[model samples]
Target: MPEPLQIGVVVFPKVTQLDLTGPVQVFSSVPGARVHLIWKRIEPVPSDSVLVLTPTITFADCPQLDVICVPGGGGSDDMVNDEEMLDFLRRQAGAAKYITSVCTGSLVLGAAGLLQGYRATTHWSAMDHLAPFGAIPAKTRVCVDRNRVTGGGVTAGIDFALTLVSLLIDRQTAEAIQLRLEYNPAPPFNAGSPDTAPPEILAFMKERIAPFRQRRSEAIGRAAARLG
Candidate 1:
């Protein structure tokens, strides 16, 4: 029998659970795919959405991965500067087939100094931080730059994972899985992005995340310097 496809996702405190879970669900559905939630500690980690997930393996024990994903959320602010986690990710990516992230998770990948010179995307709010890491930030929902794959925002993990299915397995398999999951998306409102939202709403939304943006900018600056 062929070896199972090994996938590892970094699970940390205060992750935006959807960013991790969405892709994980997709990956788990694929035949011969083994997904591992990895962390330095094996304890349960909390998310902003009231979900607590346990890690499947510690950093030292994780096998060489086919994919290494980082999911971002409120906790990413702290993770952006976590030297231990950054070092772990850096070492893992050295052997992984693909290096990836979702939403603010890209910021964490950036901290690990992984996205440099890659075309990548993150949650719109955190996109600007990519430049400091030598990343060529794209404005799309999903991007594949060489072996570096990235998805934007929380929900984009699904599409990104499906994209991975095509790359790792085959288009036929990915399509079948998408159909099995009924992956059609039809948002009720046309207000998902700044260009689609009204002026006042965009202003308000930007204001709401100003603090996070400022903090990310500062943290990424420091992380980028480490790569220098």
Candidate 2:
């Protein structure tokens, strides 16, 4: 029999749980696919939300993965400037069949130089930051360029995973998994994006994240310089 498809997700402290969990659920549903949560160490990592995640393998022990995904949150601020994390991703990208990210995790992939010249997407607020890293920012829910796939914000992870599943397996299988998961989304409020949200609500959110965005931009500057 063929070996199972190996997939790895990099889990770090302060990750937005949904960004990781949503994709994991989709990836896990694939038959004959092994999904591994990886980190610097095999320890519980706290998330931006209440849920905590534990890594199944450390970076040192992870096998070459068919797909390597990074999920973003507050933790990504530090990750963008983390040489060790960036180094690990760089090494993995050399052989990983696909390199991907969800939410701000695309920023981490950008920092690792994996996204240079790739068209990618991230949370709306951070989309502009991609250009500094030489990434063409695509403002879509899911963006796929060559072997790099990225999802916008948190909820888009499921869409990203399903797209990946279609590529890795088949559309019929992806549809089956989607049906099994009851993935039809009919959100009560159509305010998920800045374009759809109320003007005041969008302003409020932009204001709320301004401080973090500033810090993240600064870190990205440093990471970009390092890449140069």
Candidate 3:
């Protein structure tokens, strides 16, 4: 039998814990699949004030991967402005057979100049930033264009990873994994998307996240200027 496909997942300080753990759970379920938590260095990284995870491989230690996935959250604003990290993402993603992102990770990819002319999606609040990077912002929870794949906000990572499993392996396997996890979602709230969200809720969220949005916007502008 052929060897299991090797995958690398990049994790950094302040990445949403769910973004990393969700995909890890799905991809690891695939038969003969191996996933490594790759990082700029081999050390414990903290996410949110409570969660800290140790890396399985460092930049110099990672093996070439069939897939490389990056998950993002609050750290995205900083990452988009980081030359070293953006360059590393560009180099690693350029060589991977499939490069994927969850949530604001798409912004990092865009900042790295990998998403130019690609169709991608990111957290809805930050979707507008895609224009500077020359990517068409997709409204879907998951968007795949050639080797690049991106997902919407936090919860969408699970769905996106399941879709990837189906693409790489088979639909049956994906369904089985979903079934095992009871992936049938039941949300008490009806407003998941911008179009469906109540005006007040949307306004509140937008207002609350304004500072972060501004930082990311500024970062994207700088990245675009550099690329230009």
Clashes of each: 0, 0, 0
Better of 2 and 3 by lDDT: 2
Q: Which candidate is the best by TM-score?
A: 2
Better of 1 and 2 by lDDT: 2
RMSD for all candidates, in order, please: 1.0, 0.7, 1.3
Q: What are the Cα lDDT values of the candidates?
A: 0.90, 0.95, 0.87
Evaluate model 2: give its TM-score: 0.99
Alpha carbon RMSD to native, model 2 = 0.7
TM-score of each: 0.97, 0.99, 0.95
Residue lDDT tens for model 1, 48-133: 87788999999989999989999999889889889889989989899999999999899888888888788999998887788887
For residues 2-66, what per-residue lDDT tens digits would candidate 3 score against the true structure? 97798888888899989889999999898998899988888899986598989998877777788
- Which residues of candidate 2, in runs, are more than 4 Å off? none
Candidate 1's error at 3, in angstroms?
0.6
Clashing residue pairs in candidate 1, if any? none
The lDDT, on a scale of 0 to 1, for candidate 2 is 0.95
